[model samples]
Target: MSNWKKVLSLGLVLLVVAVLAACGGNDEEANSEENNEQTEQESNTDVNEEEISIGQINWAENIAVTNMWKVILEEKGYNVKLSVLDMGTMMKALESGDLDVSLEVWLPVQDANYLEEYQDTVNFSDATWFDNAKVGLVVPEYVEEVDSIEDLNEHKDLFNGEIVGFDPGAGTMEVTEDLIEEYNLEFELLPSSEPAMLTQIGEAVANEEPIVAPLWTPHWIFSEYDLKFLEDPENIYGGVEKIHHATRTDFADEYPNVSEYFKNWKMDDEQIGELINYVENADEPIEGAREWVEENQDLIDEWVQE
Candidate 1:
């Protein structure tokens, strides 16, 4: 217990305590610097983005809904691009990220094919409009000879032994073919484009001639012409279908505001039917959509949610 020994021990203890204190301070400083760096990195990653791309088909429902979104998204200070494509091609585009959002995806019926294939890769919004879709043997109301699908086969000669049909790829067309088989009808399901089919119907109706064509709901023809769907007793044509909006899975995340607006969009049979009529009467589809948007500013305002 000499003085020198005691001083040496005290000095060693002080040296150890000093080293521990320095290490703790260094650890604290290192943690603070790491956290600051992480915060800055995250802030740097948080960029404001505002552009979106859309894909749509040429069909009546698709055209109307797609153009409708195109007009509104533009009004919301977001750059929106709408590309016209076939159903299959549109699905492919959405999957590849070439497009951001798409319109008029009919579920459990018309768009069943596309949804089955791309539901994993794509995201679907809640039904914009519940499925009120109808596909049947549509005839001008003037043709009183055929009231139900059964009556059509009896007067096949009136319809010229031919049934006009829309694009071959459409879901209605597929079911129509099945309908023909299911009913065992002796008729030809002629495949033609929408415009061509419309032209035929217009010409036929102009002269009050009889024509049986495969048609659906929310179409301009329903509004402009007196048409009736042939009663389907066998339930071959199935039931009403809903229309939905679709996008790449990352769509809602990348463009949350736009996504919210999409989810907010809802329309009924009359509203959509009116839009289709407007488009059918207008010179061009986009102009028709623009006119509709202009006329329905209040509804659009409601759809653009905060």
Candidate 2:
């Protein structure tokens, strides 16, 4: 009785110890797997946190180019956000680093004041996207009588005693106000948005009525309408300017690749006009930009190449 009972009890104790050891090993393996999964998830979050914000103005060319870059950056695995802002707000955002980049900045004249104010805080691209850009009072070709700013005063009534203008804070509108004072024109400068000004132009042109409004080149409107820029004898609206992109001062150091892309970015009249046309006609602006990006893969690749 003593020998057999002692042997059985010893065997049972050994078996129980072996089973507990096996269970501890499994627990360790499960914990290791769980930790590895957590690390992988954290790594993916790091990758996805690579985000960029682009500021866009409501202007036609600005809208076109901003969305185009948004699509391109998103394709390159960036979490891109597009923020539509007004001129003053955009400039301030860039200065404060609230916005990462802004694609459309008319320089040497159109937005000279903004550059002068924010140059210290914002970094402008080395290369311009478009050149020979003009801004002035535009009239349909049918308003042949009003060929120059000097002639605008005489025909103020034709434009309904108002010069249909773009947004109030826009550089174009500022210049238009100065033009009125310089020319001693009686017409009031109406402050409206780009789309509203375009609608006014469209309606007046369709009816063959005279309508003078603030306008700029590289815009789709010129392509769609028979229009002429009213000659500025005083040259208040400076000669051809350029369109440039700007970013927060620290943006380049943080995102050198994106900064390089902005530096290399450029577009000619035909190219920008085509983009604007696509954006303007499409049901959704971003979709239009996506279509353009899809069609211009080679061009984008060239831009993004290291």
Candidate 3:
């Protein structure tokens, strides 16, 4: 081969190599930009997730329902948190927009005042469980002498002329005072929380002693003990009640999907009673709720609408 021919071939090979190297560089640069774009898109999706904070009240149904929502929201890729609070504090939190949703709000019976107070600032879903809740004076079936509120004044000494009541802010507590006045019963209400009141009832029932206290339905206590609501012909105890969902006013606008899910949520008496029983018997409410969510995927599917 001639020297000029060899030199020409070498130059041709070097030019091809240089061109391929430049193309490879461009390809690497394009790949880098593509990765960066994908990362940004995923980060934006993460930001779109709504962080839902719930004001879970101290009650069996509240514990079961709120934690159940926590599990469902988390499953749907939402950020969820629960704050265990009393009815008063929970209402305040909802009014201030600090809490996102609460699945249990007994109304026209136990939480009417709270509802009326916060109706302007907070939002409530349609009645979730209707005609299940009942609130009034209750006693163990063993207490045969006191079948009605009117009989309470006659046997006031049996109960020490004291009526066990629920939380100070509890609607039942407020109504019970009216009961004392309407019945003209010479009894003082012992203000306490739900758990404390339950403990009192448990002790009295175990001892077969005559005891009178505020009680309600959709409560695990009814399943655990035999109790009856005293006759209130005057209807001072009101009528059959329902449970509603409560959320912050801005929640729906901020997260439409979640709001829709809540709006469609409903649980019947048997469903909630079983859930409350599970939670009360489980190691923790959240743990039980997680298991319930897993076992009840069909129900969840029905709830999470488009």
lDDT of 3 at 55: 81
Local accuracy by lDDT, each model: 0.80, 0.85, 0.82
Model 2 clashes, total count: 0
The Cα RMSD of model 2 versus the native structure comes to 4.8
Across 1-306, the per-residue lDDT of candidate 3 in tens digits comes to 999999999999999999999999999999999999999866544335556788877777788888888888887777888888877888888888878777777777677777788888989777474456788889999898988898888998999999988778767787788878887889999998888889989999999998899887878999889999899978887888887888889888777777777767777788788888778888988889888888888988988865
Off by over 4 Å in 2: 1-50
Model 3 error, position 163 (Å): 1.2
Task: For candidate 1, give the lDDT.
Answer: 0.80
Ranking by TM-score: 3, 2, 1
